[model samples]
Target: MGAGVDYIFIGDDFTGASDTLATLARAGRRVRLFLDPPDAAAIAEEGLDAVGLATEFRALPAEAIAVQMDVLAPLLKALSPRIVHYKVCSTFDSSPETGSIGAAVAVLERHLDPALVAVMGGQPSLERYCAFGNLFASGPDGQIHRIDRHPVMRNHPITPMAEADLRIHLARQGLQDLLLLAWPEIEERRATLKTHVDELMRAGKKRMLFDACDQGHLETIGAALGGCGSDGRPLLIVGASSVAEALSGDLRPPGVAAPAQGSRTEGLCLVLAGSRSQVTAAQVKAARRFKPMPIQPRHLADKTAAGAFAASCAAALAAGENVLAHLAPTEDYRCSGAELSCKLANLVAAILDRQTVCALGVAGGDTSSIIVRRLGFRSLAFEEQLDAGVAICVAASDMPQRDGMRLMLKGGQVGSDAVFDRFVSAMNTKSPTTPSGLWRHHP
Candidate 1:
């Protein structure tokens, strides 16, 4: 059991899953993320220490989330992992209707039935903090703002965060009676921390939150969680990629080493974005090498328009040029978010069916999930860190043409203005005439 994969995670979105992949791999762990639960033979073949399933529940309704988790429950129970992490966004922006974190916790609890369910309070590596029960994150302007007051999240299209106190926020989604171990309490020695945790467990406080304001705090929380698994009761943790970082004992600065150069085959580089986030919009604007093509909401529902759009993109890629297909930054289409995602995915799939691409970049969590699933990729391996929470992965597929395709998945708010540029640069660094190192897994 100790030699097998130590952790199994179900990320709320593809971007979040990739971030955890980066966290574990950078810590020197052999990790792999599957589009679905793989068999024992597949796990052994990959030689993995961690496995994850990428999902788009962050953009789904509560009923939809329940149905999705129901299918995943039995799969998780069969793995018998040391820890099962339900990865959420660091800011924890969710509502009852869409992206219900509590809904997921309840579903997982009913199935796995672990002795304890822990919620890690913050991920410092991403500049997010949890202090005295409130969540704070760095805004796009580099200002520290309470999550509820953060400029971007407060006005987020899908799940706007209106509560700063996580207790209150989660309470809205029907989660209550939570026990919190604040930072001051966490700063004490390991013995004291362990005693306090034991006491809480004895008191039947199965759902608890641990304060994590900095790297040191996260390490302490990590040690506590690591200890629990050794004691024969691995906790069901709910939090961000920081949970992976903590468990792996890797809190070093992210993106420390140069990202591995991607495959540079003589094919087009296609970058697609379904996020209207300011950060993603900036990246789209900065991606000067690619031809920008915007798909309107109306076109998504019309097959003729969608096919035409796909044709244009295919033509662009066939001309030995890159293409950036995205929604305009100013467009707001809430009701059509899912439809637009599917359309974008189908559009990309169609283009890929026509032209060969050296690499593909997907921006937006839901968009990444839909695209990856639609493309029929079975498994992925961590390649490199193209940005803060962004990873370039190598796809393993049964289709020969799409096999070993390079993919970059990014959350809406992650990456810098020049992230798209860096992606193109990564592609250019490799010799177009030679085979790519990304074809083989380093682990």
Candidate 2:
């Protein structure tokens, strides 16, 4: 088949890919989305042509990976887009399947020109809770480096590389106005980040971006360094679960409850707690305790309910109605099997229908990882931050039938205070009606 489009979004889940497409569409780019079979209608409703791929679900990681590759091969061959955008998980290294990256890369190599494939690796863990730096860079050699110091990075385990080494790497890549993303897990590392940012500025780096997933940090950083991106561009920071904390000014210490009657908006809050059953339970309990209103909980295990909810939410959002979506797996805690796969396909399909979801949230590590993968991303990974905190994603819908959604990956054990705060804040700052639909949700 002849090449039919200019861009291909691979690896992201229904919600994320749709949101990204919404963002791109807002920028006036004509894009075609390829998602799993179940999400085709959501894509079609959004006025974008979407193709679905068939594959096996819930097999061993290796086997499942094979199925993914086999299904995507034909679509890649047929579309032949100039740009193949892979929305990869940042925490792939932590997954059971060791060769996911290699396998995914191999599949892409066969279908698209390697040079044209740009991997947008989103850090799901760092996006949920407060982290020290905005963004960090890791080279192919496995060395880690950062662009600025973030308080949360202090005393963390993730290693930090020398600023000089990072600079050398970037210079070698001939990357100008480049953004670096990293999870700085120690005090020394945070210091190193500050130094790096200063050095990069001194070196005349035009644009520097970081991932600040928490709200308080965003404001603090915003105050400390006014004007986001260099040269008048908003510095891009991926704010995750802590987005609510930043927005609602509720970055209180864990266990400290905010007043019972606080002003908060109604929207979906996705609490992404990896497979820890206890963590998921706590989030449900916490939501009941702190929410401004009685937030109804919907168990998504029922495929029909899950799918219908997803579709209704998408359609509502497309019609310019504010929506709050909180997607958590069932109490059974089953993922990565044939049954789970089918359920996920339905959920994703629902989300894809309405690209611009007003406020979206996801919890659970495995759930986060799987969702990220479904979005057509290739290199990003999700790490555990704060034991378990909710990651928050926020996006706006400007035009009818298009969607822009943001993501915040929160740890399960993290307090509900931070999660709720960030969600409210994101809703408050949503962009009003604009010409193009933009999917500016940070995952």
Q: Best TM-score goes to which candidate?
A: 1
Runs of candidate 2 with Cα error greater than 4 angstroms are 1-3, 12-34, 37-60, 94-99, 113-360, 368-417, 421-443
The lDDT of each candidate is 0.80, 0.36
In candidate 1, position 416 carries an lDDT of 87
Model 2 scores worst on lDDT over the 10 consecutive residues at 378-387
The digit string of per-residue lDDT tens for model 1 on 129-198 reads 9998889998878898998899999998778988888888887887777788899889966456766787
Q: For model 1, what is the error of residue 148's alpha carbon versus the real structure, in angstroms, after optimal superposition?
A: 1.1
TM-score of each: 0.91, 0.39
TM-score for candidate 1, residues paired by index: 0.91
